[model samples]
Target: MPWPVAAHRSRLLLRGRILLDLRHPGAAIEELREACGILDVEEAADAVRGPALLDLARALRESGAEDGETRRALLRAQRAAGDDPELLLPCLAALAAFHDAAGEAGEADETYERAVLLAPADGALRCQLLTAWGESLLRRASTRDGAGIVDRAEYVLREALKSLPARSAQRGRLQGLVGSALAQRFRHLGFLPDLFESRHLLGQAVRAAADAAVRAEVWLQLGRVRLEGWHHAGAPVLMDALQAYESAEREAQAAHGSDPGSVTAARARHGSGAVLALMGRPGAARSAYTAAREQWQRLVGALREVDWADVELTRRVESEPATGEGRTRAERELRDREEGDWERVAPPWWPWTGEWSNWSEFDRS
Candidate 1:
């Protein structure tokens, strides 16, 4: 490839990343696909082929492409990466995240381990990989037989924090992850010591967070710990949890420039509602729940309006239409998924039916 041609492809890759960040995944997919196609045609383009495929995979994921397509892209990138740790580590991390999302815990764990072992002694990249692995563990810890997972998550996150200086930018976020993992353990065992330590670490995280969005999440986690404390202690802890939730709501709103439909804001509002109900304030709880419902409704409505079909995937499927019945079934499934995305996205705490009976037990308590 000539220098100018290589530069042009680089520019396309950069533009695709920018579009992805700006939430234009469909456009990003087009730009990245062309860049990947350019590299594919070159006889000796292995140097850039891996990165181009990786970018294309990211764009496809953001565009809601099928898991199989995304997996194939990642696998291709991995093969092209061949022995280059710089390229291979990222491919591994993305594959780990994909496997984690699909609930393939063994694959996710193995991939994360490989990436971690291949990483250099210490740096931002190593820290990031550790953090991603820890978070994945924390998520899995929410399921059955999770006590061991919590311990592993805590160990992994703490190891990442050990190399960081006090004022390092990642300190607050790592602290938050460690705290959350400990909180999960506390829930599992009703261990007051874990609860106390989690509260303390999360408080530090909130104070040290460089980003408002991160601070908001820390605040929310702090509220959860305090609420758990209340279950064991008393009313004072309940009030403290309520204050944490209020701070979370404010910080979440500030982080997104007061976007009323922010997912974090909705979560904060839902937390507030739960705290209010626990505090025997039915009217206030109802008001908070109503606000959360409205915010979630806006988000759901926006998602429903998106055109989820990937143009390339659609064309390929269309080209091989063996029977009309097959196309009709595929169409029906896509429509069903779009219609039910809200149910999949919404948290279990969300009031799906808007019935006061859903909270009657709490009210009576």
Candidate 2:
């Protein structure tokens, strides 16, 4: 390939990466898909092809596209990551997320377990993995609290938090996660400390979050904590719950003028209605509940309409192609050339059990 063409393609690909990092997945997908097209027609190495495919897969998955095309992109990336498991790890993670978005929780958990199994011993990778796992558990807890997952999430996050500097955004994120997990546990086990700590950590998360919607989510979560407190502790804290719920509503309204299909926003609206009812304002409570119900219904409708796209193209490309794998070496091949290779592949953990599957006859304690 000509230097000019390669340079142009690389530039586009880099721009796509920037867009993704900047939270513009729709634009990133368009640019990265274009870059993939350019590299696909040329004699690109797997190193080049793999990153492009992986990045594009991420863009697709982030945009909530879980169709045959997304799966194909991830599978091509899996093949490209054949020699370097580290490269393959992210593909698996993204695939798991895709499954989660598609409402296939069983498959999603299994895929994530595979990623955990293949996770490199690198600290950053492990931290990211824990973050992903915790987030997954939190998402799954929408139906039922995964007490085991929450316990493990808090443990893992504690370790990860120690590595991050005080007051950093990453640290703040971990704090928020731990708080969320604790709140789930509090509901299941009635731990007062968990409820109180949850409120504190959620407050910190709201302060640290740069995105308005995220901050709104934190406040909504805090509102839940207060409500839970009232339910478990009695009427003394009913006013506290009402205040928190109103705060949640104020934050959510400022974040999105309309409901915006956010589960957090819906819950906030509902919380406001419940709080008003508790405060003896039936008319106002009815209005709040009606608004909340309409928003909740809209969210359900949008979720049901989600569809996968471009399947035949994806499936056919794999069957017709004979892809080369000459440049599929791991990134560590270059980075750790002098530092010596890591020879150990640690055992994978079981999400349901919160234990390592590779360890035999080991005590859980």
Best by TM-score: 1
- Local accuracy of candidate 2 as per-residue lDDT tens digits, 214-285: 566666667667666655554335567666666656766676665445555556666676555444454565
Best by lDDT: 1
For residues 215-240, what per-residue lDDT tens digits would candidate 1 score against the true structure? 88888888878776755654235678
RMSD of each: 16.0, 20.1
Supply candidate 2's per-residue lDDT for 257.
64
Instruction: Please report the TM-score between candidate 2 and the true structure.
Output: 0.64
Candidate 2 CA-lDDT value: 0.61
With a 3 Å backbone cut-off (N, CA, C), the pairs that clash in candidate 1 are none
Name the runs in model 1 displaced over 4 angstroms: 1-25, 28-31, 257-259, 301-365
Q: Which run of 10 residues does model 1 get worst, by summed lDDT?
A: 356-365
lDDT score, residue 179, model 2?
A: 73
lDDT of 1: 0.69
Clashes of each: 0, 0
